[model samples]
Target: MDMVNPIVLFVCFIVLSGPVLIVAGIIDMSKGSGTRGGILTVLGASTMGLVYWAYSAISHMNFSKGRVLRLKGRARVARRALGDGWADDATPDIEGLTPWQRTVLGEAWLYSAGMEHASVPAFAKLSLKLSAMGAPSELLEACHLAALDEVRHARRCFALARAYSGLPWSAGMIPELSQDRPQRPSPAEGDDWSRLVRGSLLDGCLGEGLAASVAAEVSRRASDPVIRETLAVIAEDEGRHAELAWDVIAFALERGGGTAKQALRQALDALETQRSPSLPSIPGVDEAFLARNGVLPQAELGRLMEECIQRTRARASSS
Candidate 1:
């Protein structure tokens, strides 16, 4: 799941351009070269069709901007949390891989890094909002730790991206954000309770739960030992992150009661609409190749996603 890099999109569009051929074919026909013109016209129409397909696929295969970011009106990756103690010394084994494989893997990790980078602030804000609601110190502490873990996750993915692509990409910067707002985080208030519940249910529990499941599958499928090991570590961390989300929901339900339950139900109902559409067919990223490189191919990813969503709903209902 790579971010649709605008630069790549532009390059692809140019390479797939059919207008020039079409226009030339029209000119050739006006000059009495009907045979050549007919051939060119047919080729041009076919090329145009291919171009349309490519554009559709690329647009549909957009980035997985995590749900937490979406809840806060920060759906786009902010590219903050600059380079520091983010990467590890572990080397990703990229030997014997085709150039396209390397690229597919690199972009996958790069997109993941962006999502993880966004989570740092997401957790920080969660902590602040919880604190405003007079949440327990343990919950606050977990939020802080989760933010740190996201920093580590982003670093690992960034390191892997650089390793696979030989590109010098870093999480852009760390912005200064003040968590001290004048607003009271009172759980007694209806609006506060609803916001807290919605955030915990949609962003935390559902989002992180799905993330953990997907990472586990990716880890299981990877043939590259180093990549497998890296994802294993990440998958384990994501499981804990999902637990923390549930913990938040648990606390919210305890204090907010029926109001919280209603919010949870509303959030659960919204899941179907929010579920990502099936990924489009990507170039050089077929089912077999992606599975071996720690990436779920489109079909596998779709199935896993449905499973995760169903599991999340069951868990949320019981909780």
Candidate 2:
């Protein structure tokens, strides 16, 4: 409401309506009923009209006479979360990721990295959208950063999956990252431990365990020296990642309130039900890699998962 230049307000209207139109068009395409498509088209057009009307009404209001008070709140929130002021170039270069790790990590990471990469601007674009809807700037900035991290993690995991599958990494059908869409207003539930575990435990701990298992098995099975060496290196990293997850969970539990404790318990329960993403059907992947690496037994993978679970459980019990 900073009496945003009229042009900025107009552009915002377009940006907000674009997605609604895209979805309506998709629904129209899916319908074989000619009448259904017409109905959807009408609905979409009506939505666009409503949005334009609202924008026009707000734009004409005198925001200078304390009518713009909401804008001040949003700016304050942004300052709190983004710190000092927004930076034009806040993107950080991720340098330590090995090329192979970057490639294969994407496949495994797609499951949860939307949440993980919540820090990225791409993911946070929605939060920026909400800021326009009267959300504080700090909250929007927090959302933005969270989306950013999730997207980057997705990129890393996809890179790893590509190497494993021998297919070039692409976003393809990956779901767009989400933040604050569920509309929980309670602070404690929003901050709960179970959500923490769901967000962190699988990837941080069990996921790493699977990686290590695959690596160890690959070392035993692979005849090709390159394959063996690659698995060995990747496995080492997975092991470290799993350990890091455990440490983080522990720290979160110790420092966190009621939500963290409950969430940890639930996360431990989920570990029992966890399964790895099905290995892609690459040429010779079954015989050349999985069988040789002892992953064919499948039970071995279960055992590795169990080991990770036990470690997590023990940490929780101690806490």
Candidate 3:
């Protein structure tokens, strides 16, 4: 009994189940029994089945995608660690360690920041994928610009983190981030409004809001002038990003009519429901930093949601 074989079998089972349930749903919907009770039963069962199938399918796909990314990321890390020629271009040099070991520690923090900031570029790529769903070319360009800004911010932060720690830092210290795998859109893909709304919620509302919160905290906590200034600049850029996201969402919603409004409301409600009571834990990131600086409470997860809602509502009122 190969352990890996069972995992592969389980994946196959999920793939089969997803299509089967979807087909069954269509059959149930097509049945014209001309009876209310039968219709209701079919409707209820099929709806439940579809929902379950959809959730499982998405979870499985997301997991598989994440695994592939991790594998590729590990390869990159290994190559860098092995003193590969390509690594030098991105890696930074560490100077003499401060007596306090702050240089090494700061490097770690900045490493995490770089990875997180990599999401900005990741999202820009996402915008390219989203282009099929009526996303404007300008919006995609903005995503690319935002990604560049994030990369700049990450580089600056990493350098400062190294400098403050009194470590010798140089270029090529960090490696490129792994890319998220390609995802195929479903049959319901043509629903442009839903796509825009959801993307806005995730990218603008959640991502930007969380960034702003983190930046504000970074600005508040650092005792060093350079670190403080670096954080301040990042925070200012993030603020603009968040505002730009809101503007994009509002502009789209205004032209989309009642159906779009309903979709927006539904998305917002869904976001509210999905809001967590605890903050997301990222590797090497300390909750204490956030807590100490008047940003988000370590255990709280709704900072982005709260901020998003506030921003969205304000936009609505003014419009």
Candidate 4:
């Protein structure tokens, strides 16, 4: 069966349901009844429904007959680092995959999952920091929401890893909630506001913007429907995250005065010399397979990295 784009479906669901919920909530509130709460509850339920719907739609979109959902629970596996420095816990059961392919897929997805998981803590910290800095409510909300989005992205990537390997995987030991906070540079090292702006420039503007571009390009080139679908969703979310980063930077510059701008410029200059490392080619694995599975070739990756740098530079210069 042909599958509609999960993003398109999600947008449609949001557009169709958002107004209905708002109208119903307004009507119910007008009657002085508790129906407003009910409407909000329904809206929440509908959003969850949409998430599941999109998941199912993507799962069924691909022609692969392999089982896609054999694992149990919320799919929130803990991330673990192996002795080889790889963040992997389980071996996949995918048949016909070369050892190189397995290694590539496992390592790639594990890194992706790690980043997603890490983003949860990153955003949470950002939200707290922004709040303490007296940022506007909208920015605070965006930071919190971005954290939630990262959680979803982690699960989604983990699911993709499982699908590729056809094995139930684990990330090893789960840590306490308090231990999950991201390790951020302390204000003792430098000015707090400067650190914040620099972090935003390096992580949000440069890192996420580059990731969005790569994800979008990979989505276009991916032959596997499921991989394409997953990358598409990631690309959209990452683009938004980048925008949020830029927005926060703008806000900081507006309020932070010369110190913030100087810090941002310095960070950009420091990052300018950093370049993406090229992926090593495996002897037997075809580039086609790698690309199909969401890995861009060296040439394409280099181009994307250049584009990201240029875009970030442009934004910084214009600011």
In order, candidate lDDTs are 0.70, 0.44, 0.48, 0.65
| Tens digit per residue, CA lDDT, model 2, 283-314 | 21233333442233344555655666677667
- For candidate 1, the TM-score is 0.74
- Candidate 2 stretches greater than 4 Å from native: 1-175, 178-193, 275-289, 293-296
Q: Model 3: residues >4 Å from true position, as ranges?
A: 1-108, 126-141, 160-190, 254-259, 273-309, 313-319
Residue 78, model 2: lDDT of: 13
Q: Write the per-residue lDDT of candidate 4 for residues 1-319, one digit (tens) a residue.
A: 9775443344455546755675676668777867665766578567656545433433222111110111111223345633232223332345576543554465466546655766776687678889889999999888888777776776666666654533344345445444443456465434767877877877788878877888888889987676787788778888888888899898899988998988887888867775776444544466687777777776777788888898898888898
Spell out the clash pairs found in candidate 4: none
Best by TM-score: 1
The parts of candidate 1 lying over 4 Å away from their true place are 1-67, 80-86, 173-190
Best by lDDT: 1
lDDT ranking from best candidate downward: 1, 4, 3, 2
Cα distance off (Å), candidate 3, residue 178: 9.3
Residues 120-157, model 1: lDDT tens digits: 88887788889988899999998888888888787787
Report the C-alpha displacement of residue 134, candidate 1, in angstroms. 0.4
